[model samples]
Target: MRNNYHGFTLIECLISLFFISLFFLMLSGVFSQSQQIFQRVESREELEWQIFLIQFDKITEKGTFRDMSSTALIFEREELHEGKVVTLAIKYSSNKKYVYLSNNGGTEPILTQVQAITFDRQGDAILFTVRFLNGVEKVGKWTIP
Candidate 1:
């Protein structure tokens, strides 16, 4: 007598299950790593923002207003070397998606991924509004001293 069964044996079944679980384990690890990378990127962007704010505060602290518009803030500060006043302009370029700092005739971009900026005078202060590319908005007041 001969008997035939078309089915997986216990060892075969166990091996297949183990391989499937291993695949899932690797997949979960990849997912977790991706999440960690995203979190790190987010924190780095926040750090960049903090640095930008510190630089902006330092530049505008004792600056005298020269001119201001919706897209630019021009100011003058005395040079420490020769007692000569130098013109500085903070300009937001919608086309370039950056905030530029221009000293005298030289220009350099200071902040990036900016959408729009507005400067308005309020009493003895300047009310500034910044709109970021990700739809975040910041409003602040800078008083001239």
Candidate 2:
């Protein structure tokens, strides 16, 4: 009498399972790396936003308001240079994508990666909203002194 077995050997089954587990391990690693990268980017964006707010506060607190528009604010600030008082005209404007600060006829970007910015006035305070390209919105109010 003879018998035939149509099944995988123990070694073959173990090898196949090892390969499947290795594939899953690699897949999990990819997901983990992507998640970490996303978190880093989000944190960096938040940090940039906080720094921008600080700068805005500093400029608005000590400067006299010259003009305010929907996307721009101009201020006249006095600084002492060489024992002489110099009046500086500073303009903060947003051009739909980023914020710029202009002084002495030169313009530089103060913040980047933004979608839009709006400025509104409420009594003695200025209300502003910033929208980032990544769908984050920040609202800030500063009182002119």
Candidate 3:
């Protein structure tokens, strides 16, 4: 007696390979999308940190603002900084208040809760406040006299 054995034909093997390739191609798309999302998150965090540092440095420096008054004043001007106009205003309400930094035509408030500062017509003795997106507030005072 003779026995006949049969294995997968060439066509069957080729079909299996094609299916596997298709599956992997689909999976690769998903993996690439996830990687892009992670990169975007990292970029956002870096940008936030850099902006916080710039704001901190500007506030700590004494020459950033010249004087404090009931009206707003332009403290520093940078054409290359995010295309936003930067200014410092001294707002005297019922009590003495200071606005250290502002932006976007002085419509955006960067710093608040300013307690006291010395301001003269000569633009001497600057005091201001710094606030970060994390809600951290820092008070900086400088005396020119």
Candidate 4:
């Protein structure tokens, strides 16, 4: 009788390789998608930070103004030692409302958003907020003075 050996045939090796390659390809695709999502999130975060800084600077430097019926008035100043306050208010599009930043004396809308605006108060105390795209809000408050 001839000796019989059991082993994987050439077809088996090829099939195994094909499955392995396919798995690796799918994994690479998932990795690429994850990277893209991370980048997008980072970009959004950066944008939010930039917007906050700009709005803060404007409120701190220029003071605060309120506009009603196309009229503008300044109501607060940083030198009051009363501290500077900035509030971001968001309005819906259907209401034709705009976002406004209000300080001790005045309120002026820095920009309009369809969803939300984050508020950050600084000078004596600093406060921050995260306005999510989905209209969710998160607030952070700190004392600087």
Q: How many clashes (backbone N, Cα, C below 3 Å) per candidate?
A: 0, 0, 0, 4
Question: Whole-model lDDT, candidate 2?
Answer: 0.77
Tens digits of lDDT, candidate 4, 1-145: 8969689989999999999999999999999999999788767756765685577565545544332121122234455464655443222222433455544445555434324433344555445554555454545443432
Which numbered prediction scores highest in TM-score against the true structure?
2
Positional deviation of residue 95's Cα in model 2 after best superposition, in angstroms = 7.4
Better model by lDDT: candidate 1 vs candidate 3: 1
Give RMSD (Å) of candidate 4 vs. truth.
9.5
Off by over 4 Å in 3: 1-5, 58-145
RMSD of each predicted structure: 3.1, 3.7, 12.5, 9.5
Q: Find the 10 residues in a row with the least total lDDT in model 1.
A: 41-50
Tens digits of per-residue lDDT, candidate 3, 1-145, equal 8858579889999999999999999999999999999788656645644564476465545335444453443455444657654554433332433333444445343333434333334345444444433344444444543
Candidate 3 C-alpha error for residue 68, in Å? 25
Q: Which residue runs of candidate 2 sit more than 4 Å off their true CA positions?
A: 1-7, 82-96
Task: Report lDDT (CA) for all predictions.
Answer: 0.83, 0.77, 0.51, 0.52
Query: Across residues 8-56, which tens digit of lDDT does each residue of candidate 1 receive?
Result: 9999999999999999999999999999997886676577667777877
The total number of steric clashes, by the backbone 3 Å criterion, in model 3 comes to: 0
Return the candidate ranking by lDDT, descending.
Answer: 1, 2, 4, 3
TM-score of each: 0.72, 0.76, 0.36, 0.45
